[model samples]
Target chain A: MNPKDTSTGTLSYEQAGVNYDLIDPLKVAAQRAAAATGANLAAHGFTEVPASRGESAYVVDVGPFYLASIVECLGTKTLVADDMQKLTGKSYYDSIAQDTIAMAVNDLITVGATPLVVQAYWSAGGSDWFGDAQRSQALVAGWKRACDTCGVAWGGGETPALAGIVEAGRIDLAASCTGLVNPKERLSVGDKLAAGDAIVLLASSGIHANGLSLARKLVERLPQGYLTKLPDGTTYGEALLAPTVLYSPVTEALYKAGITPHYCANITGHGWRKLLRHPATLTYRIDKVPPVTPVLRFMQEHAKQDDREAYSTLNMGAGFALFVRAQDAQRTVEVAQAAGVAALVAGRVEAGPKQLLIEPLGIRFGDDDLQLR
Target chain B: MNPKDTSTGTLSYEQAGVNYDLIDPLKVAAQRAAAATGANLAAHGFTEVPASRGESAYVVDVGPFYLASIVECLGTKTLVADDMQKLTGKSYYDSIAQDTIAMAVNDLITVGATPLVVQAYWSAGGSDWFGDAQRSQALVAGWKRACDTCGVAWGGGETPALAGIVEAGRIDLAASCTGLVNPKERLSVGDKLAAGDAIVLLASSGIHANGLSLARKLVERLPQGYLTKLPDGTTYGEALLAPTVLYSPVTEALYKAGITPHYCANITGHGWRKLLRHPATLTYRIDKVPPVTPVLRFMQEHAKQDDREAYSTLNMGAGFALFVRAQDAQRTVEVAQAAGVAALVAGRVEAGPKQLLIEPLGIRFGDDDLQLR
Candidate 1:
């Protein structure tokens, strides 16, 4: 029996506070809208003009062995954070700055690159001219300070005073970052992956901004203290808002150490199953899933969510995962630990068609039929 | 006489069918919520990361003369496009793409860099198991085509299936770009502007996607053909959706011609008045504004807007303006013409506290109240 399936009530998109049904019509309309823009072409042809679609960032070769990537974040998180009143205690600017960094650097590392520069765009809600200025400066300064500490260059940004859409006190923050990747070190999903490789997990700080819809629903159902102060005295907000760990140092260390993992993936919104986009049948034998952090435990208990649902919806604890040679697993953990991350030899890979099986739990998830697929 | 100032009946954000006031409160709530996230940083030696209040994009240096800029368009346009049932026309995508390009390249050029690559993020309303594949492919292809035609590399992109906030038919498109600049050729507002530099104007295609809040209202009050179609028999959608003119060629021409303009500014959302960001008092004498394109004439007639309001909000005909030496005025126009852009001498510089004077009309606008400083 699934220990955590609490309520048998039907849970749908509307129940989760989102109307999923409207999406198809919206998409169809969007395609038609996109087609009408055929006349808007640039001189070099429309071939290289970045169409307004896809991932928040993309990579390009600027020179030999040097690549540039751009990354951005959706403003929806800002809306959620605002509704929760997370700014007064934590400095909303700081959370967004970290989010900006997380959004950018995560992608950089995913593509085997190191972040080098950061820029941000902040759209303030108010019409109080000076208030906007102060907030804009404060936000930029915080981002600059963070980037400076990370040894990344702080490129200038745009502060748009969008009075009509943004409210007096609200501000929407998005960031784009450029990073460099050595052409030879870039990794794609199709890169060869053989069975018997070890799968390593780097513990995550918690939610890290993706899957907020479900997380929000779970939080809404819980008693107040469940998110703010657990029985253990830890505030739920702090645990959930932990800035995504920057894996630059670790990835850079691995690169320098001449340890090239067969695959490295950021375990974000959709969790472990989404990472298996490669053409290999592999089963992961997990004798140890990281101990449930306090926040995760609270969410599971209060929301009555099943283990599979929790794992599928949240990062749980692992923010990044690595597929490496079984022989090199020990060294990989050592290297990651040296970089200050608590790395765990989470699982082992076995021969199979491209599949993800969680042992001990006996839960199997695959790319085919996945929620997002 | 302001013939286009048709009484749209005190139209406001809410009355325009968008609840800007309600959205404003939501914005404040969201900002406050985001602020609460900064207190969780325990290991990075940082207590709080400031909120990105107004900055929209961030740039970080990955290598010499190479920088990455990341940005996103708030889903405002997406919602509007979806409501209009013109999805495949891609007005939203194309507009956002142009705006993204404009925002990035304009900034890059401000710092004397050339944009070389662009990456985009597209979130379809949902994961249409079968339809998503084809739609995503087409979207990517369109984005790639745009980037390629602009002489920039179409790197990689992400198409996330976000089924919640975005309805089935609506998609949000955002992008980031990488640009290259010679350390020596960088330009800023402080670069130098004498009293005699002539201002050259390059034509704008249409509204080019900014100030839509007002434009849409005006369109609604007018007849069906008022905004999207003109007396010339061209569809207004096609005209309004005209792709932004890439200024790269013009910039390159000016550079190669050895005629460094006092300033080369893209006439976008804020128009002429916002261009006077420098400290010096400079007066602009406008003997000729580019011929009012059919779209502008239609907007003027239908909306019954004043010249100042129209010029300040829309690009009119000129998309880019250059402040060049009086002697090089003719050459600047010739070069722009050679690059397939119709350029003409629109105005000239004069001694005064840095001010933009639309002569003949005798209207002067400045950044006195708008300046962030």
Candidate 2:
């Protein structure tokens, strides 16, 4: 095992930047506010309201089918793209759009729904050079092209010209998508699972829009031009800018195959180990972990980042993880491969205390194992 | 006419302090990046995508109904809320949640769909004094309350603790809602709208979410303590923080009564006249426009705004407008009143060159007529 893969006992978001103290009070305030609204729901006319807080997405059973929608936006990624000077590249818009879709679709899929329509709201600083009619058209065109490919209808959106809040040359982009699911097939983390299931790994396309803030911090500390070069000759920016892998294909295949996995989690900004939010007496033995991609290696080498940190903070290589019956592993892999995705038997479920243990490496990674340092 | 409201000039985003030029380029870049991910939709095995851009929300057709979702966030609203030093107010979250719902549901209802579910996403700033645990809970509560009141379901959501992207105390809130629209009952803006239709008015809470950049600027320039008093003694901040009126009840009533309105428009941040976006000969005579709310009046007086400007920039007490057959005018008002809302027979729709002419006042207001001086 590489030493870099081990815990570094160093601080992260707390040290690099960001103030958790302030966040604590704000969170409390948010909860209070949300509670007040919840009390007012009946008067306001929202029926079938969820009972929990912080769950930003919801579904309503409308007769035989269900309606679901999700809202998300490209965070500081706008700033990163600006800093990297990649805003003009056609791929820039493409990546953000994908992120927007993934953010919404991933949530919808969690509840066993398929996306149908998507809407976006965009705000940008106003300048004659910035609001060029052609650029606006091109941006919208890219969104349409992406939505077209996703089998989702494109709903109308808002493009507000904000003058004060956003700095000049900066734009904020967010999207909302609606989907449909069978009420009987609604999937949630509460679904039952047993030991002895096989874990399947799906390859990821770089960072996929989640932990860019951390990545940017790490990159900023590196020596000049570190990201622009690599042993493979690909610019770090180019490598890191790889679009996120959309899991809809594999998910659909599984659905069609009549296989409902015990758990399916997308590896995003938080990584594979954090997928299970609850304690269960099951251990995961990951023996066939996919090899780390070049982007991960580059960040590790240049930023002196430890492997565990990298894996926890970014997708590394794998984009998604699915736990299913051991007997179904081969079929799952085959189905995924048939859909043009590389699926591997990365691990297995084992009987044990509710914990995530990485075999061979002798490491235990789970919610308990994660720390800012 | 108030001098402040009628002074027509170009209202560029820059004058409000947001730099749209810088933001536009960033928007272009983000869109380009998002496009790459779209191709994966096909690779992932989805079907029937649209070819229009700026559509961030999508819909899926189920046997008898269509499911649609929208994703959007309160752009710059977070900044404004933080600026007002009212981060903990229930009104803050309530208004934003209302706006999020309104943003998506308005569009859905415009096409004659019934909103069923609302999914929200909240990204808490790292330094927020309130931690996400409480904040997330509160947000869910708020969403649930909103959805329940509207007879919409509360779906789950995502609460991402974005360390680097969001500043502490500056939380971003967004929601996407899935709605059901009977195939046989679809509504479009191109429907048969003719002269002599009555334009019914539904009241608004306040400015709602749009034009914040400008409003903030004007407020910033006001003398200290300008918002300190009102005839009723409520603080200006409290008045501005009022939540938007939910139109679901009134809309649902109209739909149930089998009254196919010639046209329905949400009189949002853009005000009454911009509702005519189609290419038809139409004229609007707003003879009894609702009295401007105290909040709006105060803003106008403090900013030295003219009548036309105020009418164009703010909802000014009317949040929704409906163009109905002349015969249905009285029924529309009764329906609205039955729903516990105030309504007014504000205007009449007449045949003209796709223009909105405000008669009696002899002021014509339309998209082209809007100018920022």
> What lDDT tens digits, residue by residue, belong to model 2 across residues B196-286?
8888988777766666655565554445432566566765666765666778778888877777676677665456555564456577778
TM-score of each: 0.74, 0.81
Residues B208-299, candidate 1: write the lDDT tens digits: 55555555566556556323556788765455555566676677677678877666665655555555644566677788877887866666
The candidate that wins on DockQ is 2
* Model-by-model DockQ, in order: 0.16, 0.29
Of the true contacts between chains A and B, what fraction does model 2 have?
A: 0.30
lDDT of 1 at B321: 78
lDDT of 1 at B110: 43
Could you tell me which 10 consecutive residues in candidate 1 chain B have the lowest summed lDDT? B48-57
